[model samples]
Target: MTTEPREPRATDVLTGLLADLRAESAVLDDLVAGLAPEGWAADTPAAGWTIAHQIAHLAWTDDWAARSVRAPEAFTTETARSFGELLAAGLDPVDEGAARGAAEEPAALLARWRAGRDGLLTALAAAPGDARLPWFGPPMKAPSMATARLMETWAHGQDVADALGAVREPTARLRHIAHLGVRTAGFAFSLHGQPAPETPVRVELTSPDGELWTWGPADAADRVTGPALDFCLLVTQRRHPDELALTAAGATATAWLPIAQAFAGNPGKGRAAGA
Candidate 1:
C-alpha cells in the first residue's frame, strides 16, 4: 500500500526553526570558545569590526528583540533615544553600536551574548500566536523574527570564520536564508530606489541534502539558479555575485544579484569579488 506524506503543523515548523537557531548559535559560540584575547580583537571581513564586535552586536540586538516582544513601549523609547544619539553624532548607527559593544571585556561580552540569546529564544517560544514584535525596519511575528535572528547569526559567523581562515561546512538550514532572499527581491529593488520588477523571478536552488528547492513561478523568464549556500551568501552580502556560482538569466534578475539584501536597514556596501 502507498503512504501519503505528512504535512507540517505550525508548532512543528516553529520548533524546527528554533532548533536551527540554537544550532547556529552553538556553532558560533564553539568557534569563539577557544579564542584568546588577541583572537577576539582580530578584524573580520567587515571593515573595522572585530570578532568581539560581531558577537556583541548579536547580543545587543537579541536583547532589544526580546524587549520588543515583552515590553514594546520601553523598547520603542530606548530605540528612539539611541537613534537620536546616533543622528546627533553624525555616525552610522550600526557601526557605532558595534564599536561601543566591542569595548566590553571578551569574557563579559560572551556571557552577555549567552544570556541575551537565551532570553530572546525564551520570549519568542512563549509569545502569543498572534503577537508581533517591532524591529528597526518592520514588525515581525515569531517565526520571521526567529528566522531573521538565525540569518544574522549565520552571516556574522561567516565573517568570523573568514577572519580565522576556518572552513564552514554547508548545512540544510541555509534553505531559510535562501527563501528569505527570494522573498525579498522586491524589497531589494526598493532599497536601491528602483521600481520592483513586475515579472516574477524564478529561483532554483540545490539544497545541501541534494534536494531541489524552488521559489517563484517555475516558467518565469527571469531566473536565478545555483547552490543554496551561494544564494544565502549572496543575500547576506557575505560573498559578491561574481565570487559565487549563481547565474541569472534576465536583466532584472541579473541586476538584482549585485544588490540583493535579505536583511533590513539601508543597503550595505557589499563585498568585492573574492574579497
Candidate 2:
C-alpha cells in the first residue's frame, strides 16, 4: 500500500498565513465599520489597548519584521539571542497610552495598518525561501518569518472579535495557526517552569466548510477535539479550553491547555495583547 505525503514547505505555510491574515482583516474591517467613533477609541479586552492601538501595533510589528528581513546582517548575535527575552519582557505598547490620556485617531490608525500589511504581503510574495531575517533567536527564513506574522495577526484579531462580542468564523486557513500552536507546545509548558509532559495529545479540527484537520501521533492516548474556532481560541489563549467545550481526555492534555503557546517565546504571566 502507498502512503500519503506531507506538505512541510515553510514558504507554503507563510503563503497560507497571508491568506488567513487577509480573511481575518476583512472580518475586523466589517466589525469596525459599524462602530461609533467612540467605539474605535474604546479599550479592547487587553489591559490598556483600544482598537486603534491594536491596529497600530500590528502595523508596527509588520514594518519591524520587514526591516529585519531586508537587513539580517545588521543584527548582532547578542541581538538574536536576546530576541525572545526582549519580546517577553517588553512593556505593553498600548499601556503607555494611559499616560497620553487617549489613543490616535481610529481612521488614521486603520490607514497605517493597511499600509503595513500590504507592504508585508508584497515583501513576502517576492522573498525567496532562504531569505534570512532577524528574529528573537538567530535568524529565520522568509517562510518562518511569515508564519510569525500570521500567528500574531490571527491571535490579535481574536481580541478584537471578543471585545465586539462577535465571533470571527474559523476557516481552513487556520491550519497554519494550528500548526504553529502544535509546534510550540513544548515551549508553552516550559514558560511556566514545568517539564514538558510525556503524554501526547491529539488535535482534530473541523473546518468551516466541513473538512477535517488533525495532528500529533495518531494513537496518542490524549486529545483535543473541537471546531477550529474553539481550538484556535484555546491555543491562542483567547479563551479557556474547558470553558469552550474543548475535549481533553488525559491529565497531560489538560495541563497543556493552560500554557499552549503559538508565538515564538514565553508570552509571559497572563493573557495576550487583546484576549
Candidate 3:
C-alpha cells in the first residue's frame, strides 16, 4: 500500500529548469552584488580572468542563448560570420565574449547581465517544448538549455566564491551540475579524439543533502562514484581530477575523468593536481 512519486509533466520541464537557473544566478549575484570595485578586479583561479570576467562570461553567453532561442535562423547567420572571424584570427569566440563584457564598468556590467539573463529566461519559457535551438556545440531544447545555464552559473559561482574567500553552502541545485557531468561523459572522450564507447557508464553520487543521485544502467560495467560536488567540479574543470576523491572503476570511466567537460567547445588545458 505505498504510493510512488508522481512523474513531472512535460510542461514542467522548462518551467522547473528555468526556476533552478534563476535561483543559481541569484546565489552568485548575492556573492558579488556588493563587492567593492577592487573585488571585481581580483584574479580568479582561471588564470587571466578576474571576477568581472566570470560574471561577464555568464551574461555574454546568456545573451547568445536568448538570440538562439528567439531566432535560430538568424542566430546561425550571425554566429557563422563573427565566430569565423574570431577563429581566423586565432582567437576563441568564447574568450572574446568574456573580454568584451568584462571591460564594462562594474555597475553597468552587473545591470546588463541581470537584464540579459532575465531576457533569456523569458525567451526560454516561451519556446516550444520540443523546439531545438542553435548552440556553440550541439543544438538543445529549452529544458537542456536551461540546465546548461544553471551548470555554468554554479561553476563560475565557485570561482567567485574562491576569489572572495567565501564558502558557499552546497545546495540541491548542484544536482543539475552532476547530471550534466554524467551526460557529457561521452563528449569528454569524443573531444579528446577517442571513439566514444558504446557502453554506458554508471554514475553514483552522494548529494549535498545525503540523497543518492544516479545515471546510466545500474548494472553497467564501467562506473564513476563520488560526492556530487567533486564530480561537478571535475566535469566543469574547476578542480583537477587528482585534487578530488572521484573513483573510476573501468577504462572508459578513468579516461573520462581527466577530460570530462560540462561546457561546450574545446577542452581546457586544466589545473595542476593541487593548484
Candidate 4:
C-alpha cells in the first residue's frame, strides 16, 4: 500500500525545526566539551575572536533570544536604549556582547551556555504559535527564530572547527540555513545598500546526501547552483565565493553571491579568497 505523506502543519514544522536546533547545539557542545582551559583562548577564523568568544557569543545571543520570547517588554526596552544607542554611535552591540561574555571563566561560561540553551528551548516551546518574538532585526516567530539560531550555531561552529583543524560532518540540519538564505535575499541586498530585484532568484543545490534541494520559481532567469555546503558557507560568509564552486547564472545572482548573509545584523566583510 502506498500512503502519501501528509502535509506538515505549522506546529509540526516548528517542532521539527526546534528539534534540529537542539541537534545543532548538541554538535557544538560535543565539539567543545573536551577543550582544555587554554584551548578557549585559541584564535578562530573570525578576526580577534577566540574559541571562547564563539561559545560566549552563542550563549549571549541565546540568553537574549529566550528573553525575547519570554519577556518582550524587557527585550524592547533594552534594545531600544542600550543596543540602539550603541548602533547609533557607530559601535557594534554584537562585538560588545561577545567581549563581555568572553570575559567569564571558561567553566562558568560553559555552564551558563548549557543552562541558557535548555532555558531557551523551554521558552521557545512555550511561546504561542502565532506570537512574534522581538529581535535585533525584524520580529520572527518561534520557527524562524529556531532556524536563525541553527544558522548561527553552524556558522560559528565552522569557525571553531577550522581553528581546531576538525572536520564537521554536514547534516540535514543545513536545510534550515539554506532556506533562511533563500528567504533573506531582499534583506541581504538592502543591508548592502543595493536594490533587491522584484523577481526572486532560484537556488538549486546538491545536498550532503546528494538530494536536490531547491527554492524559488522553477524557471527563474537568475539562479544559484552548487553543492549545498558551498551555498551554506557562502551565505554565512564563512567562505569566499571565489573559493567555492557555486555558479551564478544572471546579473542579480552574480552580485548576490558576494553579499548574501543568512543571519541578520550588520553586513559582514566576509572572507578573503584562499585565506
Candidate 5:
C-alpha cells in the first residue's frame, strides 16, 4: 500500500518560530503601549481592522488555539472550515461580544489575552512530536503550526506598526518568514497561470542571531537578499520592500514579486514591492 510522505521535523525551525512569535508580540505591544486613545481607533493597513482590532485579533487567536487544544469538543465540526479555524476563531466570539456591549474592560481583555497565549504555548510544548492537528484549511504538525502563528503575528503586527507610523524592531527569527517566501516560489508562478520559472532563485536572509539561512542555489545570479523581516513584509503585502533595504536580482525574481503567496488555497494578486 502507498503511504504519505513523512513531514520534516526540524526542532530548530519550531524553536525559531516560537521565538519569532514572542518577539513580534513584544513589538506589537510596544507600538500600542503609550498610544493615545485616538491611536487605538486609528485605521490600519488591514482593510477594516483598527489598531485596537488587530491587538484584539491576536489575543483572540491565541485564546482560540488554547481552547481548541484543551477541549476540541466545544467547537462543532460543522462550524469549522478546518481544525485550524476552530483555534483561530477561539476568543473572537468573546471579543465580538465585548464589542457588541458585553462590557469587557481593557484590563479584562489584557488578562484574557495573556492567559490565552500561555495556554497555546503550554499545548504546543505538550503536543506529540508527530501530532497532526487541524488548522485553518489543512492539517499541520507542530512545527508548521508554530511557523504559521509566527507569520500571522508578524504580518498583522506590521499593519499596527504602519498605522501608528512606528517602526518595528525586527529579529533574525524572521528567517522563518523568508523561508516561507522562498518555499512559495513555485506557487507564485503557478498562481498567475505561468509555468514555474526554470531558473532557481536564491534567497539569503540574515537572522536575528547573525546567522544566514539560505535556500536554492548559492551562486545563482537571480537572488533576493535582505533582512528577513523586510522580505516577509514584502511577500505578505504588509509593506513594500522598496521602502526598506531589500534587494532583488534577475528578471524572474523581480517578476515573481506580485505573485508570491505563502498561504494555501486560491492564489492572490498581491501588490508588488513597488506597487
Candidate 6:
C-alpha cells in the first residue's frame, strides 16, 4: 500500500533544527579540542585559511548572530563599526577579521568561541516563534538562521578535518543541509545572474542511515538524485559536482548542479573537478 507523505509540524521542525545546531557545534568543538597546537596553523582547503581561521570565523559569526537576535540596533551599529574598521585598516572584512581572530592564542580563541556559541544558542532559543533576524544577506527566521549555522559549522568542520588528514563520519544531520540546498536552488540561480527556472525539480537523497528523504514534487520533470552527503558537499562547494555520484535530469537540474550553493553570498567559484 502507498503511504501518505508526512507533513512537517512547525514546533517539531524548530526543535529538531535547534538540536542539530547544537550537535554540529559540539562536533566542531571536539574536533578543534583534539587538534595539536600545530594543527591550528595548518592550511585548510579554503586557500590561505588555517584551521584557526575557520574556527575564528565561526566564532565571530556566532557572536554577530546572537547580537542580531538579542539587539537589533546594537547589531547594526557594531556591524557598521566593524566594517568601517576593516576598511580603515585596508583589509578585506571577512579575511582580515578571521586572520586577526586566528592570531589569538588557541586557548583564548577557543574560550571566545565557546562563549559566542553559548550566547547564540541562548538567544536563538529565546527568540519569538516567528521572529526574524538579520544576516549578511536577507533576514531569516530563527529556524532558518539555525539551519544556516549548522550548515556552516559542518562545512567548515570538513575543512578542519581535511587539513588534519582526518576522516569524518557522515551523520543524519546532513539531511538538513541537503534540504537547504534544494530549497535554495532558485536563489543559487539568481545569485549567478540568471533568472531561476520555473520548472519544478524533484530532489531524492539517500540519507546516511539509508533512508530516503525526498523534496519537491515527486513527479516533476526535472530531478536530482544522489547520496545526501554528496549533495551537502556540492552545495557547500567542498566537492565538485563531477566528483560526486549525483545525477541530474532536465536542463535546469543539470545547470544547477555546478552552481548549487547552500549559503547566502556571491556565486562562489566551485572547486574544480576532483580538486
Give per-candidate clash totals.
0, 1, 0, 0, 6, 0
lDDT of each residue in 150-221, candidate 6, tens digit only: 999999999988888788889999988998998899899999899988999999999988999999897999
Scored by lDDT, model 5 comes in at 0.67
lDDT of 3 by residue, 193-223 (tens): 8888887799999999999999999999999
What candidate 6 gets wrong by more than 4 Å, as runs, is 1-9, 84-90
Per-residue alpha-carbon lDDT of candidate 1 for residues 52-125, written as tens digits (9 for 90 to 100):
99998898888888998898889889899988998899997777778877898999899999999999889888
Q: In candidate 3, which residue ranges exceed 4 Å CA deviation? A: 1-6
For each candidate, what TM-score against the reference? 0.96, 0.80, 0.96, 0.95, 0.73, 0.93
lDDT of each: 0.90, 0.70, 0.90, 0.91, 0.67, 0.89
- Residue 217 of model 3 has an lDDT of 95
For model 4, the local distance difference test gives 0.91
Task: Give the worst 10-residue stretch by lDDT in candidate 3.
Answer: 266-275
lDDT of 4 by residue, 52-102 (tens): 999999998999999999999899998789888888999888888888888
Candidates 2 and 6 compared: the better one by lDDT is: 6
TM-score of 4: 0.95
Query: Deviation in angstroms for 54 in model 3?
Result: 0.8
On the 0 to 100 scale, the lDDT of residue 168 in model 5 is 68
RMSD of each: 1.6, 4.6, 1.6, 1.7, 7.0, 2.7
Model 4 weakest lDDT span, ten residues long: 192-201
Per-residue error for 129 in candidate 4, Å, reads 0.7
- lDDT per residue for candidate 2 within 29-144, as digits (tens), equals 78776677788776677666776666666777776676676555654454444454655777433344232323556676677677877888887777777767776543677776
Model 5 residue runs over 4 Å out of place are 1-16, 34-36, 67-105, 189-199, 206-211, 219-221, 241-244, 250-252, 264-275
TM-score of 3: 0.96
